[model samples]
Target: MAAALAAAAAAAAHHHRLSSSSPAARTRVVHHHHRRRRSSSLSFSAPASSHGCPRGARALRRAAAGDGGGNGSGGVSTGTVDPAAASSPSSSLEELYRSCATWTWRGMRVNYLVRGEGPPLLLVHGFGASVGHWRRNIGVLSESYTVYAIDLLGFGASDKPPGFSYTMETWAELILDFLDEVVRRPTVLVGNSVGSLACVIAAADSSRDLVRGLVLLNCSGGMNNKAIVDDWRIKLLLPLLWLIDFLLKQRRIASALFERVKDRSNLKDILLSVYGNKDAVDDELVEIIRGPADGEGALDAFVSTVTGPPGPSPIALMPAVAARSPVLVLWGDRDPFTPIDGPVGRYFSALPSELPNVTLHMLEGVGHCPHDDRPDLVHAKLLPWLDTLPSTTALTPVSSPAA
Candidate 1:
């Protein structure tokens, strides 16, 4: 894996804008891409595939789930719903919530579902998403490892309390708390987009050994567009960013904008912008993103996230993560938000060359959400890494520390 990643990083570095002039500079660029931003934008809508998809929710039911080291897969999306966009997946998720349990943190409810058997693996979703977003992958992942997927605060069924900061740090702290109170052991954290950032922070947490491994899919450059360099990228986005921020301050404008974003047609268009594979942007997927927006604090969550801090950059956090867990990075080659050849993607693709323990895969033709877009492809790459890890059975359980 190291050799493959080193070669991949070397290849990515050669084609990337931040390619190293010297051998040593190669390692430094992984750290640099996190600091600098270039161009990024939502693309126009692409047509969805008409091919039939197997019922993921149904398949989940067939899989054996529980953490007794059994060979099976399963999980539930333990949370409430806003009732706007209902589907089989949503019904199953709500059932999971009914069957499992929830956590109350600082007066906010966090819903989570766990299944299968092996080392614990927690799944966190990106912005405007929830545990339901992971419907395709969780059951399969549970087969080999115990899987825990949660609706982060302010998203999904989780409470979005008024006056909450909703910053990256806030989310990261939430992950840490979940680890301490729920998992009660060092677990592998798999995150996509902003969820990856929170996991990065959780892995770096020194208060307790919370995370033992990481899987980042299309990890975000920062929490917002402001992460871009002051050059062309920033210049182009500044005006729009300012306009959006200005409008969000007013409830009426914010509601109007939110409505547009929530539109099913616009939702498909938004997915096409970052999803390399148009076929993955199906009715179910759109509904997953849509339902949460109807949840009570969804609008507030969006406003705070857009205006909040970008959070700790990989440059600030990667080194520490590198020092601890072996990292697996899977990037969608077609992701507009962080293209494989783009500056941010360059940093990520070049990661393995600098940090030998980290392995990077640029999933061809995949987009921002590879796990959801092409779960089979993701599983093929992910399973081998899981095979290489030490047995979770040999490890002693770490008790949750006092808060």
Candidate 2:
């Protein structure tokens, strides 16, 4: 159900030619650069959840015993996957899963984990996803940098209270707070899909120096609304979105829908739809995603996120964010929702022209979440770019330019 709803959100923004006074946006040929877009909320601060592994390191380690226990928080090992066959040769899947941790924020548990050292790097998952989503990249990136992967509030082990708004601003605030209170450093944020939008907002935040850099993978164009700009995609999907948005809001109905989609078979099918690499959509991956849906607040959070307002698009957030920080924009050219040939793609293609500091890479034949679908390809491009950036010690001064 979550995947279905998320797909709708992406569809609405597929045809957008951003309402940019920028010359590039104005001249963007219709259907030439497809860009698809696809967020949450609440208030009050909970006591600082221990920045340390919340589930406790020992409990997480025990998850390696088998998938029978339901205790793991945010790593793929939170379920079970053949450690031998994972993408990273250096670390087993079970070891990665053992890193799962939990933090309390605003009266709810937020699941996350940390690994390695050096400058802090945080991974934010997209809609219906958790830290486990980044299993492939975390182990490799952690070799040189402290890699933190978290299940956003209402997803994974995070507490999902009823009545949360589930908007972009909501998640952005949480990201900022997590940086200040947990990682306790100005850090680079790497996000996929909706998570990318949250990182954009966090980097632009006026209140904190939490984000030092950003990497957006197959970034969503909008939050939860239809196309923000004038486009046929909006006209085409508005009615369908209206229906899904309505159906998702009902409690019993939402739960029923969740049950159907959470089925292992249904889950695999949905994953295959978005993941371009057919081989990667294995049973373990499906179980990892399905595992979180049964947890508390999962259904409610899904409904809220699905029916929620569309947050600012990259067009809306990029100018200010790019001025303050360097951004690496990655797009899977084969993304069905936001084809590289669609409006979203055009917007990204035009980015380098507007912000010379921005680096954009188009991955051929990949889908919505390139980081997960092709970790090797993503890392091949990512690590080199990361090396070029100044050290964390050098980054703070750039963010503030101390007098």
Best by lDDT: 2
Tens-digit lDDT track for model 2 on 1-403? 2435555333433432334212311111112111211111222232222122222233333332333222111112111333234334333445555656666665556777787766788999988887777877766677567788888877876777655667787788788777766676778899988899889988887455667788888777766546434456656767777777776565545555556667787678778888766766776678668887887666667777778877777777789999888788877776766666666677877787788768877766567888777665566556655665666553242222111
lDDT of 1 by residue, 96-167 (tens): 445444676655577677766667789999887888788777656765567788888888877776545677
Model 1 residue 254 CA deviation in Å: 0.7
Candidate 2 CA-lDDT value: 0.65
- Give the runs in model 1 whose Cα sits over 4 Å from its true position: 1-100, 393-403
Q: Each prediction's Cα lDDT score?
A: 0.63, 0.65
Query: Which stretches in model 2 have alpha-carbon errors above 4 Å?
Result: 1-3, 6-93, 225-229, 394-403
